[model samples]
Target chain A: MKSESRKEEIIRAASILFKEKGYSAVTMRDLAKAMGIKAASLYNHIDSKQEILSTIIIELAEEFTTGMNQIVNSKVDAIKKLENIIDLHIDVTLRNSDGLASLNNDWMHLEEKNLQYFEKMRQEYEENFRAIVKNGVDREEIKPFNIEIMVFSTLSTLRTLYLWYPKQKNIDAEILKHDMISVLLKGMV
Target chain B: MKSESRKEEIIRAASILFKEKGYSAVTMRDLAKAMGIKAASLYNHIDSKQEILSTIIIELAEEFTTGMNQIVNSKVDAIKKLENIIDLHIDVTLRNSDGLASLNNDWMHLEEKNLQYFEKMRQEYEENFRAIVKNGVDREEIKPFNIEIMVFSTLSTLRTLYLWYPKQKNIDAEILKHDMISVLLKGMV
Candidate 1:
């Protein structure tokens, strides 16, 4: 494998182990074993286990923030923007379930710099939802509710789909996305 | 402190630490320090950290199951029973937020026997909602929808309130409960 591909492979293995066993329980040697490489050879690709966690978390945060930023910047009405946000969230979460799990569950283990980066990305993502909800309310597309609570509740609800959404099922991501957005919008509408 | 009060103090401290830091990050010594006692002193109040986790989890599970059972046995209609279940869920969740957090987030740390007990309580709690939804469908009280999905989604949504529901606010639990139940019922109605 190319160097980049090998690094990605190590990240993938590490993400799964970290999700299952948690960050503290996982070790560099464990990642090496899972990657079918010697423990000493693993140091060539990653500096430490914390480095692996930082890579996975930062990448996932980037994916989420980037997706939301694109949606917010698109030329769409508030309702459509909300729909798109939900779609992007479900898509990212389902596509990167392990990474999402680590983001939610293992984020605390990231180094200080990485933690700040992740938190900033998360706050940016929340701002997207907040803007969408505020715009919708102003347009009378959604019912008047506390903007902060509505935004937090909606995003938190979507974040939790990673825990129970079965990947093997034939459920289309779009359909699930539309259904969730519809129900939440209905409640607010 | 009295022995009973000392035990309560330990559980309370442990729950706060577990919520702030996760199960893997906390140690017996940490709990001891939180309680201002030596590490070995924790043994007098609890057998182990696992024991503390099990106690908190099982207690929450029992509260949920017992509350649901009482609601199930009540003479109210299925729709009202469903509403009551939602209200009780929010009430118990708000009152015992820490315990619920431990149950939802730290359940995997439980030993085999305790895990089984917790699972059984969870299934029983879920069955109450399923029973209500199924009966409502039969009576045409609830709109026709996928029963399994509806049950899981509703329960999962309510169960997650502990993660973010603000306790310091003056929002009335009953009103919040009524609104949540209204939203779910309205969507199906």
Candidate 2:
């Protein structure tokens, strides 16, 4: 494989292993074994196990933050913006199940710089949700409540899809998104 | 401190550390340090870190399961039972916040026997929710939907309170519980 493809392959393997066994339990040798490569050879793709973890979490955070930011900033009504948030959330999480797992469950292993970057992006993403909910409440588009709790509770619950969502099932992502957002919007409104 | 009091203190300290740092990140030495005792002294009270983890998780699981079971078997309306479940859930989570965190986030580190026991209790708790939802649907108290998804999603969302709930500044526990169960019941119905 080309160097780029080989590196991507190593990341994919590491992401799965890290999700399944966690960061501390997974070792460089384990990643190498999973990739059908020697431990020494694995060094060519990644500098260290922490590097792989950092890469996976950074990628996941970028996907979520970018998707949420774009949707929240788009020229749309508050309800539409809320719908887009749900769709974007499900889309990113479903496509990157292992990556999301690694980000949420294994983020403690990130270096300080990487962790700061993630925290910034996460805060930005949260601001988007808060903005939408705040706007909705201001414009009488959504019900009045503790906006902080409402936004955090909705987003936190959505983030946890990684825990129990079955990838093999035939559940249409859009339909599931519709159902979840409908329930949430109904409660909020 | 007496032996029993020392052991309780160790477990309490271990619970806080586990909540903040997670299971794999915490060690026996860390627990000992937190308790202001030597590592060797920890061994006298707890056999291992795993033992502490198991004790904490099982204690929380027992509380949850017992409370849920009582609500499930109660001679009450489905809606009232659902409210009871919500109230008990919030109470257990707040009363044993550290234990709840360990049970939800660190269960994978538990021994096989403990895992089996905890899993059974969790399933039983889930069944209680399922039964309440199903009964509500049959009694025309709830709307028609996939019971499995609805039950799991609602229950799991409630379980995540331990992660982001602020005991100091957030909504009071009783009001939060009332709002959550009201929203859930209204959305379903």
Candidate 3:
């Protein structure tokens, strides 16, 4: 792993702190103290706690948006696209579960323009997901279930992976990816 | 609907307030103001805000425990038991989604024995779910995908139904139940 910049270190520490205590509850002093640095030194690298939150959240949101965009535009079928999407989530989760936790819980605390940008990315992600499911139905690539139900069930499972995956120590990444893709796409029975 | 007892009235009003503004932020005055009753009147029915929160959450947790116990004890096969569990969540979501919001978002605020009780019920609920899935695999009634994966995927979707079900107006209960069971049990493709 490459040495992280001071800003990256601050963001990383803040993400974990935010996950534990929530965005509003975490102050910069708490963050600096966690890092064994003085509080004033933090302002040199980042402006405010909001900046840390937005950086942690927006960066992850954009990562998802980018992943979903590529998957949606790919020539693969809906099921394949979905597999890739699941892999994207697992990949992100494995690398930075703490950051994902902050993104999930602290995105709402984003201010003004950054908030709008994050929301837009999220909505587009969902819309792209919906369109893929609808396309699957139209082409008979998938079953004729309620489109919204299918979308909601699958997305909800994927979205909550950050909370579930960490507790699972016996299950490795490859097994998780393979089993998750199957259970999600092919069902349990 | 049957008439609500005065205590029930306070619990219902406080649940909505808790959902709107999280349990920590909402005050007894806020709940009383929302209910259009005097603060002293609220005290007459409910002992404290903690009482209101515990009543909403512990009651819902007990309801799930009861429903799961019946499902687990039934003579049905594992797949049938899983379907029954899905129906239980839908029934509860339909009945008191606001109370569920508190249970999901603020159950940690439940002090003392109530917190312990809620966690125990939640763990048992998950254990029973795991047992049913394992039984299904043994009986060849279900695929042997990672038991934890299957359980997590299904339960996460069901646990989050309260948040999603309220926004979906066009989909009636029948369709939601049918489609959810199908998508969760049989997969989307």
Candidate 4:
């Protein structure tokens, strides 16, 4: 394989192990073993286990950051913006469900600098999400419920879609997205 | 402390460690250290680390089981039943947010018999939740979205409330429940 594809393959293998055993429990040798390569050869593509983890997590985080930036900059109404945001989550999460377990559960185990960066990105993401909800409430487009609860309920459901979406193989993406919006934004009642 | 209170305290400390390190990473010695007790004394109240984990997880699962049974049997409409189900989640999750981590992330680590039992409880819970959603759709009380998607969306949000609820300390329980019902059952749009 080409060098770039080789690195991608290594990261893919690492994500599977990370998802199963978590970051701390997993080791470079174990990852190499899972990939059917010598440990020394593994080091040729990745600097260290930390580097592999940082790649898996930071790349995925940056994707969200980039997506959220686009959504925030759009001139759409809050409800429209929120729907686009949900679409972004479904798209990104479905594509990278493997890395999501680490994104959700193992980011804290990142080395100090990476940990800080992840935390900052997460904080900013929430602030931007809250802004959308606040705008919706202000425009009376959304109900005047507690903003925190609104954000929490909506975001939490979207955040964990990776866990549920994969099991639902037969459901079309459009159908799933429509149903999610209905249940989450339009309320089931 | 009395024996019963001591057991509770042990479970409490175990939950904190379990939440931070996960069930597989946490040890009996670590639980004792967190509780400021000896490891030998730890065994006096709990049979093993597995038992501590089982107690934390199985008890919570059983509570949901019992709560779902109550809601399923109620004479109320499907929407009311769902609201009651949501209330049960928020109440139980808030009270045991720490244990909720174990319940969500660590149940897979449970030993054979306990693991089987936990899985059984979870399967039944989902079936009953689906039944409620199906009833709603059939009665024309709920929109005819895909039943699995609706249940997945609703339960995923409620299931992960433990991750978000503790952080929002200022939100009152009644307000949380009301907003949740409005956003979930009524949709924000």
Q: Each candidate's TM vs. the true structure? A: 0.85, 0.87, 0.97, 0.94
**Which digits, one per residue and each the tens of the lDDT, describe model 3 over residues B1-189?**
232587888888888889989999999889888988888877767789999899899999999999999999999999899999999999999999999999999999999799999999999999999999999999999998999999999999999999999999789999999999989999988
DockQ score of each predicted structure, in the order shown: 0.29, 0.31, 0.91, 0.82
lDDT (tens digit, per residue) of candidate 4 on B59-163: 999999999999999999999999999999999987999999999989988999999999999999999999999999999999999898788778888988898
Give the per-residue lDDT digits (tens) of candidate 2, residues A1-189: 698899889998988998888888999999888978899998887799888898889988888778887887688888788878877777877877888888887787789999899889988888878888889888877666667656755776678777667642755766677667766556311
lDDT (C-alpha) at residue A115 in model 4: 90
lDDT of 2 by residue, B1-189 (tens): 698888878888888999898898998888778877789988888798899999899988888778887887788888788788778877876777787889888998899999999899888887777878898879877666656556755776678777667553868876677667655555311
Local distance difference test, each candidate: 0.77, 0.78, 0.92, 0.89
Q: Which runs in model 4 stand beyond 4 Å of their true positions?
A: none
- Residue A162 miss distance in model 1 (angstroms): 1.6
| CAPRI quality band, candidate 4 | high
Question: Considering lDDT, which of the candidate structures 2 and 4 is the better prediction for this target?
Answer: 4
Here the TM-score of candidate 3's chain B is: 0.97
- Model 1 residue A107 lDDT? 95
Please state the CAPRI-style docking class of candidate 3: high
Best by TM-score: 3
A42: Cα error in model 1, Å? 3.3
Which candidate should be chosen as best, given lDDT against the real structure? 3
